[model samples]
Target chain A: MKRFIGFIRKEFYHIFRDRRSLFILFGMPIAQILLFGFAITNEINNVNIAILDHSKDTSTLEIINKISNSKYFSIKQIISREAEIESVFQKGKIKAVLNFEKDFGRNLIKKKSAQIQIITDATDPNTANSITNYINAILQNYLQEKNKSIQLDYQIIPQTRMVYNQELKSVFLFVPGVMTIILMLVSAMMTSISITREKELGTMEILLVSPLKPFQVIIGKVVPYIFLSIINAAVIVLLSIFIFKMPVEGSLILLGAESVLFIITSLALGILISTISDTQQSAMMISLMGLMLPVILLSGFIFPISSMPAPLQVISNIIPAKWFIIIIKGIMLKGVGLAFVWKETLILIGMTVFFIAVSVKKYKIRLD
Target chain B: MKNENVIEVENLTKAFGAFKAVNAISFEVKKGEIFGFLGANGAGKTTAIKMLIGISHPTSGKAKVVDFDVYTQPEAIKRNIGYMSQRFALYDDLTVQENINFFGGIYGLSRKAIRQKSKDSLVELGMHEISSKLVGSLPLGWKQKLSFSVALLHEPKIVFLDEPTGGVDPITRRQFWEMIYKAADQGTTIFVTTHYMDEAEYCDRVSIMVEGKIEALDTPKNLKQQFKVASMNEVFLKLARNIE
Candidate 1:
């Protein structure tokens, strides 16, 4: 045990003394979180729009006022002709164009309905869809206010609620994803590269010949990573809670334990990678290409796994990050206990065991 | 028990698929002798050394290193041997003192022993002034000598050096050999492999491996007389040509 501690101290020296690695370890997590939180967002706000109102009437004016008052759209241009609407959209700042038919209020009074054309630029579908939805919501609110004195015989109202994130704060989604990426990068990539570095420098042969057992050497290399990864996990959690107002609804102790378990699982993967790669560059390439892509795309960080093709959904079931993201979301968003996350926890445990077993077998073969 | 040989091998052969890397090689080193293993590149010298060090398993036959079976008691063999590879194995980022302390600590030396050894090694090498400097700042020759000293820090029964003086100058190689002699005088057996044939002349007994087999095993003087060559280098060339 004392020898292992000494080995860990040496590993820490390697990590702290290298400036480039230190920068990557701490700087990347915060930058990624802030970027994902502020820059890349699903919620649409202050989208530039144009309007072509042929009828200068009370109803059209009131509807325009309603759209501008809502936070989603900003009236960038008021075009008098239909030809001007296409040009404004061609400029690319205006995402949607609203056109009210001639004599809209007169038609509404006589026919009980008026046609208002909503034209959206379909080149960027998601933003166009969001702009259309926001406009519809504003019109619905205006009609509801105007119909306060009269009761309609036929009406349809749809009620919707966002459960886990009521405010739809993107940080709540990004927090768990960012934590998973950071833990995986630091614990898996760093440990694998460090071990392969020893092999490249020929120090591994010396260590193997020493009195220290093979298992002891591997444990010593990974123990420091576990500690550093835990510290990284803590930093991400604190940033989420304080800066983003993301709450931890479940038990903090269970969250911490599960995070450590995931960190161990990642470290085991690192060992497994190191066993296969003889050089540091190969280890890094394998970690980045093999692990990072699956964690980002297939783990349901941005896209819903259930909505993907069947083959991709089946492939995602084997990714450890998918299970971890579910565990973290359950704990942080749903305020759930161990019973709710036991299945994910078991998957993580199984992956950890599998990685360890394969690596141990490979390591023994190398000894032979 | 005290008179037992430190290393013993009998027809130890290692094969990879159909190709034999080390073919039926057998040798022994006494408790305190500078045994040399010499060969040209790809002559299976490294493969044989690896098996003796218990890192590679032989496909057939048996071997005992430091009185521990290579097949079953590898851990015990590892505990009794120190190794330095062709490449310098010290951590370049670590300071001279920290490198010594780390290797010593892993070898289960006490803190006091590590400190004393570090101090003594630095003083003996005339490098006490730069004891706190990073090893990357040292010259290649100095690093080579330090590596050898670090390998013997735990006072193992046998120290295995695979081409310990590959790229250093002759002066440094001579100094390194002097250290080997000092360790051997202290009853520490030295098993070293080298491509420098002149170094083979300095060993108490020498073995020359060619194409996965031991072509010659005797003192340098006997090999020169037997092969009718003026030097061990010519003897190696003749045997290499015959194999071809």
Candidate 2:
């Protein structure tokens, strides 16, 4: 136990002495949370769009005023002819164009329907889709306001309520994913790199020849990373709660325990990576490419799993981060306890055990 | 248990499929003997040393290190032996004192003992002033000597040095031999491998390996006389060339 403690103390020394790695371990979590919370957001605001109104009537003007008044759209240009619409779109600032047909007000009153074309630039499909949807919502609101007195005999309105994130705040979605990613990267990458560094420095040979058991050495390398990654988890949680005003509805202690488990899972992966790789560069590359890309893309962190193709959804099930994201979301957002997240918790524990077992089996006892 | 031979091997061999890296070679080292294991690079000097140190398994062998079977009691063998490889083994990022303490602690030394030994070793190396300096910043010779000292920190029964003086200056190499002699004087068996023929002279007994086989084994004077050469280098060349 003293030897293990000494080894861990030495690992801590290595971590603390390297300023760059220290920064990577502690600095990245807060920075990523802030960046994801504030900078890289999916929320649309002040989108530049052009207008083409042929009728120049009060109804068309009123619709245009309503669109511009909402924070979502800003009318950048008004075109007289349809020919100019393509040219304005080619200039590329305008993401959409609202085309009001000729005699729209008269047609609406006489035929009880009129054409209002929401022509959005499909170059950026997501924003274009959002722009089209926002215009449709605005038009629907206008119609509802105008038809307030004309009640239909049977009307069914779909009332939707966002359960966990009531405001639909993007930060609420990002904080959990960011925290998961930071914990994974820091725990897996740091432990793998530290282990491979011993191999690179040839200290592994001395260590292997020493009295220290191979598992003791591996665990010693991983313990410090677990401690640091937990601190990172805490930093991300604190940043999300304090800076972003995110809520933790479940037991904070349960959240902490789950984070530690995930951290161990990542650290086990790190030991496995170090077992296979011989150099620090390869260890780092394997961890970043092998772990990070999947956690980011396939874990449903950014993309919703339900919307993903069938095979990708199946693949996402294998990614531990997906389960972690689900677990934490259940905890922080849904305020569920272990009974709700026990299945995910079991999967994570199983993966952690498998990784540690594989690494132990793969860990070299001889320099063959 | 009171046997004079600290290391005993018979028909020890390590083969990778059909290629024998260390052929069926047999040897014995008396306690406190400085046994020089010499060979050309890739001649299995390292492979044999690794097997004896319990870091490499032998394909077919019978070996006893400190009365522990190489195959059955490698863990016990590991605890009773010290190893210094050609590669620099100390952590460069760690301070001088920290490396010593860590390795010392790895060998199950107590905290107070590690501190005392670290101070004494640093002072013996005349590096007490730079005990706080990172080992990476030290020169190559100093690093080699420091690693040797660190390897012996546990005071194991046998110390294995695999080409420990590969890149050191001649003066440092001389100092290294002196340290080996000093350790042997204190009744520690030294099993060392090297390519430098000049270093072969310092060993109490020497073995020349050529293509995984021990072509010759004797004291330096006896080897030179047996090969009808005036120097250990000529003896090695004669044996190596004849085998080739």
Candidate 3:
């Protein structure tokens, strides 16, 4: 145990002394969280929109005021001619164009219906759809308020509520995913490269020939990474809680335990990677290409796994990140206990065991 | 046991699929003897050394290193041996003192012992002033000598050096040999492999390998007289050329 502690101290010196690694380990996580929080958002806000109202009536003015008053849309341009609509959209800043028919208030009073066109730029389909939906919701609410006293037959109204994230904050979704990627990159990629570096420099031969057992040497190399990754996890959790107001509804202790388990699983994967790759470059390339894309796409971190094709869904089940994202989301957002996340917890444990077993076997084979 | 041999091998052969790298080679090195294993590149010297060190398994044969079977008691063999490879094997990012401390610690040395030994080793190398300097900043000769010292830090029974002086100058090589002699005089067996023919003369006994077989094995003077050559280099060339 004293030898192990000494080994860990050496590992820490390696990490803390390297300025580039220290920056990447600590600086990148906060930057990623802030960037993903503020920049890449699902909630539409202040979308530039153009208005083309042919009827200069009080009702059309009131409706336009309602659309612009809401936080979703900003009236960037008001075009008078019908031909200007296409050109305004071509400029591309205007995401949606609102056009009220001529004599809209007169038609609403006589026929109880008026035409309004919500033309959206379909190039960015998601954002365009969101802008159109926001406009429709605002119009529906206005009509309901205006006609509350008049009873009408066959009225249809839909009620919807965003269950888990009531505010639909993108940070809540991105924090967990970003945390997973950063931890995996830091723990697995860094460990693999460090180990392969020893091999390339010939220090590994000396280490193997020493009195230290192979397993002890491996554990020594990886233990410091576990501590660093835990510190990283805590930083991410604190950032999300204090800055983004993300909740930790479940037990904080369970969250910490699961994070450590994921970190170990990643570190084991790093050892397995180093065993297969003879050099640091190959280890890094394998970690990035082999692990990053799957974690991002199939882990339900950025993209929903259910939305992917069946084959991809099947393949995603093997990615450890998928299970970890579920575990974090359960603990942080849903506030679920161990019982609720036991399945994902078991999957992570199983993966950790599988990786350690494979690495140990490969390590033994190399010695032989 | 007073005449204990640090290394013993009998018909030790290693095969990868159909290709044999080291074939039916047997040798022994007595305690405190500088034994040289010489071969041209790809003559299976490395393969043989690896098996003897218990890092590689032999296809068919038995070997005992430091009185422990290479197959079943590899850990014991490892504990009793030190190794230096062709490449200088110190952590370039770590200071000299830290490298010594790390290696010593991995060998299960206590912290106090590691500190004392590190100080003593650096002073012996006349590098006590640069103890805190990163090893990457050290010259090649200094790095090689430090690596050798680090290998022997645990005081193992045998030190296997696989081409330990491949790229250094002759002066540094001579100095390294002196260190090897000093260690051997202290009762540490020096099992070394090298391509420098002149270095073969420094060994108490030498074995020349060709095509995975030991072509010649004897003292330098006996091999030269047997081959009727003026020098050990000529003898190695004659044997190597005859094998081809």
Candidate 4:
């Protein structure tokens, strides 16, 4: 135990003394959280649009007034000719164009239906989709307000509610993902690089030839990183809660316990990487290419796993990050306790045990 | 009971598939003598040293290090041996005192004992003033000297120095040999591998290896006289040429 403690102290020295690692350990978490929180949002505000009102009628003018009044759209230009809409979109300055059909108010009165064409630039498909949806909702709301006093014979209403994130804040989704990415990178990449550093600097040769057991050396190299990763987890959790107003509705203790398990899982992966790679550079490449890419692309951090192709969904089931994200997002968003997350918790535990077992078996006792 | 010879091997071989890296060769070293392991590159001097130091297994052989069987009692063998590798083996980012303490701790030394040895080693190297300096900032010669001293901090029965003097200047190499001699005089066996033939002349007995086989093993003087060469360098060249 004393030997292990001493070894951990030396590891701390290596981590603290190196500037690049220190920045990656602390600077990256806060920077990533802030960048993801304030920047890289999907929500739209004050989109630039043009209007082509051909009817020149009271209802069309009233509808145009309602559209411009909403915070989502700003009336940039009022075009009279139909030929000019294409040229205006060709400039690419406007994201959407609203066109009112001829005799819109007369058709509404005669047939109880009117046409309003919404032409959006699909160059950015997501923004264009959002523009169309927002316009549709506004028109629906305008009709409802207009028919407040009169009673319709039959009406069908569809009600939609965003359950976990009511505001549809993009950062709420990103907070969980960024937290996973930071933990995986810090825990796995940092530990792998450190272990391979001993190999690169010839310190591992000295270590292997000494009285230290293989388990002792590996655990000693990992303890400090486990502590650091927990701190990173806490920093991310606290940042999301305090700065981003992300709620932690479940038991905080369970959240803490589950996070520590994931950190150990990542550390086991790190040891596995170090065993296969002989140099720090190869270890780093493996950690980044082998670990980081999967966590980001397949873990459902940014993309939904259910919507992915069948083969990729099968592959994602094996990634520990996918289950971890599911667990934490459940705890934070749905306010669930152990009974709700036990299956995911078991998956993480099983992966941790499997990784630790395999890496220990692969750990070499001799230089060969 | 104690034995006079600290290392014993018979028909020790290390092979990679069909090719033998260390052929069936054997030798013994006395308790308190310097054994020089010389070889051209890829001659398997390193592979043999690795086995003796308990970090590599021999393919098919019988070997004992400090009375511990190489196969069955490797852990016991590890506790009684110190190793300094060809690569600079000290933590460059750690201070002199910290490196000493760390090595001492791994060898299961007491805290008070590590402190005492750290002080003594720093003083003996005449580096007491730089005890707090990072090893990487020091010159190459100083790092090598410090590495040798750290390897000996646990007072193991034998110290394996693998190319400890490579790339060092002649004056520093002389100082290093003086340190080795002083340790041997105090009864610590020295097993060193080096490329410099002149350094081999300083060993009590030298063995030259060629193509995974020891071609000659004798005192440097006798080996030179038998080969009819003027120096150890000429002797080495003649032996290497004959092998081709």
Candidate 5:
């Protein structure tokens, strides 16, 4: 145990002595949280748009006033001809164009329905999709008011509520994801690079040939990273809670426990990577390409797994971050208990055990 | 099986899927002798040293390092021996003092002992002023010397030096050999592997490996006399040329 402590002290020295890595370890989480919190938002405000109204009527003007007054959109131009719509969009100042068909108010009053085309530039599909949804809801509200005086028969009204995120704040969805990514990268990438660095510098051979057991050597190398990762997870959670106002409704202890489990899972993956890699460069490449990209792209951090294709969804199940994100979101947003997150917790535990077992076996083989 | 012998091997072999890397080699070293392991590149010198150091297991043979069985008692073997590898084995990011303390601590030395040893080593090497400096900032010769010193900090019965003097100047190499001789004089068996034939002359007994086998084993003088050469370099070349 004393020797193990010595080994860990050496590891801490290595980490603290390198300023670049220290920045990457502590600064990245805060920087990323701030960047993701204040920037990269889905909420739209003062969006530039063009209005094409064929009917110069009170009803058309009223609807335009409502859209511009909602603060979601700003009227950039009014085009008289349809040919001018294409040219306005070519300038790229406007993201959406609102078009009302000819005789819009006359038809809505006589026929009880009027067609309006919401033309949006799909160059950025996410922004376009949100813009269309917002406009559709506004039109629906206007129709509801219009039909309140006229008794329309056989009408079905659908009510939808965003349960966990009431205000639809994108930061609420991304805090857990960004925390997972930072923890994974720090624990896995840093540990793998550090271990492979020992191999490259021949210090690994010296440690292996010492009285330190292979298990001891590996644990010593990983313990410091586990502590660092937990600290990183805490900082990210605190930033999200205080700065971004993301709530942690469930037990903080359970959240912390699950985070430590995930950190161990990632550290085990790092040991597995170091066993397979002979140099620090190769270990870094494997950690970045094999671990980071998959965690970022396929772990439902930025994309929903349910909406993904079948094969990608199946592949995502193997990523521990997916389960961790689910667990964290449950605890933070839905205020779920351990009973609610037991399956994800079990999966993470199982993966941690499997990774550690495999890495130990591979490390022994390499030593022999 | 002599009481004074620190290393014992009998027909140790390591093979990698139909290719033998160390083909049935056997040798022994006494407690306080300087044993040189010489080979050309890929001549299995490293493979043999790795097995002896308890890192690599031999495919088929019996070997003991510092009286511990290499197979069953590798941990015991690890506790009794020190290893300095080819690539300057100290942590470059750590201070010289920290490196010494770290290595000393891992060998289960007491903190007081570590402090005393660090002081003695720094003063002995005339590097007391630079003990707090980062090892990476030091010159290559100093790093190699410090690595050797750290490897011996635990006062192990045997020390394995795998190409410890690869890229240093001749003066540093000579100084390094003097350190090795000083340790041997203190009754620590030294097993060193080197590609430099001139360095082999300083060893009490030298073994030259050719194609995964020990082609010649004798004193540098006896090997030269038996091979009818004036220098150890000619002796190594004559043995290497016979393989092709």
Candidate 6:
């Protein structure tokens, strides 16, 4: 027990003495949460738009005033000619244009129909789609209010409610994914680099020849990283809660337990990577390229796995982060219990065991 | 089978898929003797040492190190023996005192004993003032000596030095040999491998290996007389030239 404690102390010293790694260990989580929460958002606000009103009548003016009053759109310019619309779009500041056709009020009152064109910049297709949808929703609400007294022949209303995140806050989606990524990168990448450093420095031979068992050495090297990654997980969660007002509706103890399990899964992957790599550079490269990219891109962190092609969705099942993200989202957002996320939790546990078993087998084979 | 011998081997071999790295060979070393293991680059010196140190298992062989069988009692062998690799294995990021403390602790020494020993060893080397310095900042000669001292910290029965003095100045090499002799004098057996023929002259007995086989084993004077040469260097050349 004393020996193990000494080994852990040495590992702590190694981590604390390196200033750059220390910064990365503690600083990355808070920075990523803030960046993802505030900067990279899908919610639309104060989008610059132009209105081309050919009729210049009370009805067109009323619709224009309604659009401009909403928080989603800001009228930047009143385009006079059709030529001015293209020029304004070319300036790149205007996100969309609202054009009312000639005699729109007459058509609306007499024929109960009118034409309005919502031309949006499709270069950024996601924002363009969102902008068009928001405008359509606003127009539909206006039409309902204007036609409340008139009885229509057929009317179908679709009522929708967002269950987990009522506000559709993008931060709710990012906090869990970012937390998983941070934990994975810190635990797996750091441990692999540290193990391969000993190999490169030739200190691994001395360690192998020592009285310490191979398993003890590996466990000793990994324990410190587990502590560090857990602390980072806590910091990320707290920041998300305090700064972004994201809620953790489930039991905090279960959340902590799940985070630690994911941390262990990542550490086991680190051990496997170190066994395959002989140098720190190769270990780092393998962890980043083979692990990080897939976790970020294919684990439904940034892009939904269901929307991906069939094969990619199938491939995403192998990424451990996919299960973790689902588990975290279920617990934090949906306020679900173990009964809800037990399958994902079991999958994570199974993967952790498999990774550790394979790494141990590889390490034993290497000793001979 | 003699009780006086610390290391014994008979027909020891290691094969990597039909390519035999260390072919069948046999030798013995008495306790407290400086046995010099000399070989060419691919002559399997490292492979043999690895098996004897209990890091690598032999394919077919009978070997005993420090009264423990290599196949059955690798843990016992590891506990009873010490090894200094060619790279002078020491953690560069650790302080000099921390390295000693770590190795001593793993060897099951108590905290108070490690502190005392660390102080004594540093004082002996006249490096007590720099015990807190990072090992990476130390000079090559100081690091090599520190590594040797750490390997001997547990007072193991046998110490294996694999090319301990590969790239050092002659003065440092001489000092290193002086330390080796001091250890041997105190009843710790020294099994060393080296590429320098001059270092061969310092050993109590030397063996020359060529193509995974020991071609000659004798005192330096006898080897010179048998090969009809003036020095161990010429003797090594004569034996190397005769390889078919």
* Best model number under lDDT: 6
TM-score of 3: 0.94
Quote the positional error of residue A70 for candidate 1 in Å: 2.6
Error of 4 at B10 (Å): 1.3
Provide the lDDT at B94 for model 3: 89
Which residue pairs show collisions in model 1?
A: none
The TM-scores that each candidate's chain B achieves against the reference are 0.97, 0.97, 0.98, 0.98, 0.98, 0.97
Per-residue lDDT of candidate 6, residues A96-206 (tens digit): 999999999887887677888999999999789778777776776677777786543222232232233347688999999999999999999999999998999888888
Which prediction has the highest DockQ against the true structure? 5
RMSD (CA, Å), candidate 5 to true, equals 2.3
lDDT of 4 by residue, B41-97 (tens): 999998999888878888998999999999888899999988999999899999998
Model 3 clash pairs are A249-A335, A250-A335
Clashing pairs in 5: none
So what's the TM-score on candidate 6?
0.95
Off by over 4 Å in 3: A55-59, A102-115, A122-126, A143-168, B1-3
| Error at B144, model 6, angstroms | 0.4
lDDT of 3 by residue, B13-128 (tens): 99888998998999888998999999999999999998888778889988999999998998899888999999889888889999998889888888888888888889999999
TM-score of 2: 0.93
Q: Write the per-residue lDDT of candidate 4 for residues A1-368, one digit (tens) a residue.
A: 88888999999999999999999999999999999999787667899999998898988888888889988799999999989999999999899999999999887777777788999999999789778877776777778876886443223232232233347677888887898899899999999999999999989989989999878898899999999999999999999999988878888998999899899889999998998999999999999999999999999998889889999999999999999999998888777998998999999999989988777777754355
**lDDT of model number 3:** 0.89
Model 1, docking class: high
RMSD of 2: 2.8
| Candidate 3: Cα lDDT at B37 | 96
Judge the docking of candidate 6 as incorrect, acceptable, medium or high.
high
Query: In model 5, what is the error at residue A230, expressed in angstroms?
Result: 0.9
DockQ for model 2?
0.80
lDDT of 3 by residue, A35-145 (tens): 988898777989999999999898899899998899888999999988998899889899999999999988877777788888999999978866766676777777787
Q: What TM-score quantifies how close candidate 4 is to the native fold?
A: 0.94
